[model samples]
Target chain A: MSERALVIERLNKIFTTPNERVVALREIDLQVKQGEFITVIGPSGCGKSTLLKIVAGLDVEYDGKVELNGQQIKGPSLEKGFIFQEPRLFPWLTVEKNIAGDQSLKDPKVRGKVHELIRLVKLEGFEKAYPKELSGGMAQRVSIARALLRKPDILLLDEPFGALDAFTRSHMQEVLLNIWETNKTTMIFVTHDLDEAVFLGQRVVIMNPRPGHIKSVLPIELSFPRKRSSLAFQEMRRTVLNEFEKVEEESYTVGAGI
Target chain B: MTVEISEKLSEPQKKKINWLNVTYPWIVPIVIVIAWQLVGSLGFVEEHILPTPSKILTTFGTLLGNGELFYHLTVSGQRVLLGFALGVGVGVLLGVMTGFSRLAQEVIDPSLQMLRTVPLLALIPLFILWFGVGEFGKVFMISIGAFFPVYVNFFLGIRLVDQKLIEVSEILQFSFWGKLTKVIIPSALPNILLGIRLALGTSWLVLVVGEMMGTSAGIGYMIQDARAYAQTDIVFVGLVMFALLGKCSDSLVYAIERKSLKWRDTFKG
Candidate 1:
């Protein structure tokens, strides 16, 4: 259970813009335990998404070492699944086909697995629907389902519910929590919502904006089906929110009068 | 419950709801034909110059019965098919090369741009002189006419393949052939269809001119030959046959395009 799922060492990302060198990430180190749910909370432009993309191997032009399952991550593999903010479903495919997208899972048994996950995500009966026909929340569910379809060991979600409504977001969070419980897939979710971070994470990591680094990592110490109104849950949310605010202020001072 | 409501509805009611599908295309053509016929019958023009629906039908049948019409029609049809195939084949090959390599793109793009600028029909005299007034000259003319559109489309289609989609393929480590077959071609199909449509129309135009001015066979030749003998009705029949052939070929491409894009067009509403 204590086996490391991922290790990020001395990560730095500098983009050579037309006029100046922009630092997106700086000297960041992160480690994840097997089957742990880690939520990264930060203000927008805090490079939380950039960190996730780097780990996903979607962006490799960074000074970093991201290792998963005892091997260095160089590019995306079936072991790691990525869910974007938008569904980004291939418009030419139906939900069922999208979930089965470009996978080697040709076994008829795998299809049964897809149908089960479809129900787990509460996307049953809409399997044949196109992405455009689905609501924002529904489409995001399909994205999650598609991510899970590969049976990935590590699932990296970049604010998958950010565009969804409050009710829908809560429902999807619940669905995600349930799936994590059953499958024990290592998840690293990036979001700006502190409550969401507290709601989903076994540990909440707050990142600072501009030259983004982990400001703090707070353990939730809560059980599954976490009560939104519980005192511990509220306290975890408050502590993370304070850390996020302090990081924002600190970044402002450093970036002042530039 | 909403899913139940949507699913439980009868197919007939679904059809009724999408009545536009049933009526629009069918109705528009009928209306246009009726209007054209009524105008012609109501003394809009002399019968010898402009035939009504009934006169046109009689002309169509007589031309078919005489077997003179098909002799010319086949020649134009064969020319279009042969040239169009060659043009599209070369275009796709060149387009793929241009799209994949920066060095190839620089070399090919300049050449393609210059070649596309040349009017294919203007090369008719040159084609006749180079290849002689046989089938090769006309086939070459039609091929050149079809080549440019398909090349441009195939090239642009390769370049515009969504970068994200390519990333997905790369992430999966698809084999070279697998990526080309599964990702590139499907993504490029719509643009490729557009090119095919344009190229076919251009081929028809080129074939007609080639056959009319320089040959003794084809619907164009029939028209020109009729003109020489002052056979106005035969000339009109040839013109009508040209229109029909053009419509039929265009519809064939369009029908296949619809079938291919059925899933994509589902979002049109």
Candidate 2:
């Protein structure tokens, strides 16, 4: 709905554990244009989660600024919706209730919008079901529906389908792509899956290990409805894999550590 | 793919349950009662001191005809109901506060913990001295017994709410009270119900002990009065009534738990 959707300026994050001080993110700079779909891929503990947290406003102790449509993020707000790795549905609520949980849905029109989001995520008949009855992928689908119901400018996803099996994971990726195409919301997804990054992201940002910072940004020029078997897609994957290998060789942290 | 087909196939069927869930419980209780009757008939024990099932039932019928049993039952039930309601209500309110706020938890948790250390029955003399061996004293003891389990459960339930759900609530701009009522309370529900169950049991027990020393009515008083008249069958009736009431209340709570968590049972393995 607005131009220049999100901008992250030189973000820095440090974690103080009881016995150790670990740098989670350092000097991160990024820009996500309106309707842009950006996926981040790296080794585990590369501060991908930390970056998403900073954008989602869950962690504010970091340095630098995160803005959505020129407004600075003071804390977590309805302007940006987050889908965590775990579905995290309240066990007491039904699936429909879970998806419609955000405060903005207090509006009657927003209630109608939640039904649309549920259909978008392909959970049309599951409104009455509970999270416990659903499989891992199904619960995560409800979570995505929940996030989209807020109608945020940007959708921040931290590997929403990471816990699912491979086939379920692929199906979810397609669902995610379909949602992106229809809504055109700027989505910043953090994942460790290289193939996932190549398939869904318009541009894939690769980060080096902890005290994580972006090492390279690889543009995925392949068009949507991207065929996994396409030679162009395969070639792009090969190139990205080569670059990732290089970063892994030079990584300094355990996850990104060479 | 194999998964593509199954993904659309709906949920997998769970294994069939065994007969133990229903028939065996009923059978075991019946067998135990029959054996006790047989043993008593065979002169295995003195009938006057240890009344048989039939003798107890006969005494129960006589007591019922005289309204003696109903009077004690009514008195004990009233105390349990009052104490249980008061204890659970206060425990839940305090528990919610402690769970949500560090400062409140810091102030109240220590005193509540200390209060739990003093056995509730031990306070009978103090209660009599304060309230003059009356209905208030009996109700107070039951309330004390119910408080701890309810409080502990409420506290644990609140603490156990998933951190990510809280994050979701925060991002949505839910106010503190909104989060407490909508998110935190619902998330903590299963555990809270568990606390209520434990408190119910504790309250039942305290009702018996509370009436044992201080009251002239209730099952405890009935048993004490029967002892004076050597009406061992009447005492047996009181014991049987206590057992039945306790059993029925626990079963009621269990049923409630099942009804509330029905969705969970279907969804989870």
In order, candidate lDDTs are 0.83, 0.85
User: What is the TM-score of each candidate's chain B when compared with the real chain B?
Assistant: 0.86, 0.87
Q: Is the docking of candidate 1 incorrect, acceptable, medium or high quality?
A: acceptable
The digit string of per-residue lDDT tens for model 2 on A127-167 reads 66777768899899898888887778889999887899999
DockQ of each: 0.37, 0.44
Report the Cα lDDT for residue A128, model 1. Answer: 69
What lDDT score goes with residue A250 in model 1? 93
lDDT of each residue in B1-269, candidate 2, tens digit only: 43554444345335467677778779978998899898888999888778789988888898899998898899889999999999999999999899989999999999999988987778878888899878887887788788889999999999998887787788877788778777887778788888988998999888877777856889998888888898888888988898899889889988887776665655444
Return the lDDT, model 1, position B221. 87
Note the residue pairs that clash in candidate 2: A132-B267, A133-B267, A253-A257, B72-B218
Please tell me the interface RMSD, in Å, for model 1.
Answer: 3.1
Worst 10 residues of 2 chain A by lDDT: A249-258
For residues A1-258, write the lDDT of model 1, one tens digit per residue. 899999999999988988998788999999999999999988777789999988888888888688999898887888888888877776666777777766434668778877888888887777767665678888888878878877889999999899888999999999898889989999999988888999999999988877677888889898988999988778877877787788879978887335
**In candidate 1, what are the lDDT values of residues B23-98, reduced to their tens digit?**
8868977887698788888998876666676776787788899887777778788888999999999988998888
* Residue pairs that clash (backbone atoms under 3 angstroms), model 1: none
Candidate 1: where are CA atoms >4 Å away?
A104-107, A256-258, B2-48, B51-53, B172-178, B265-269
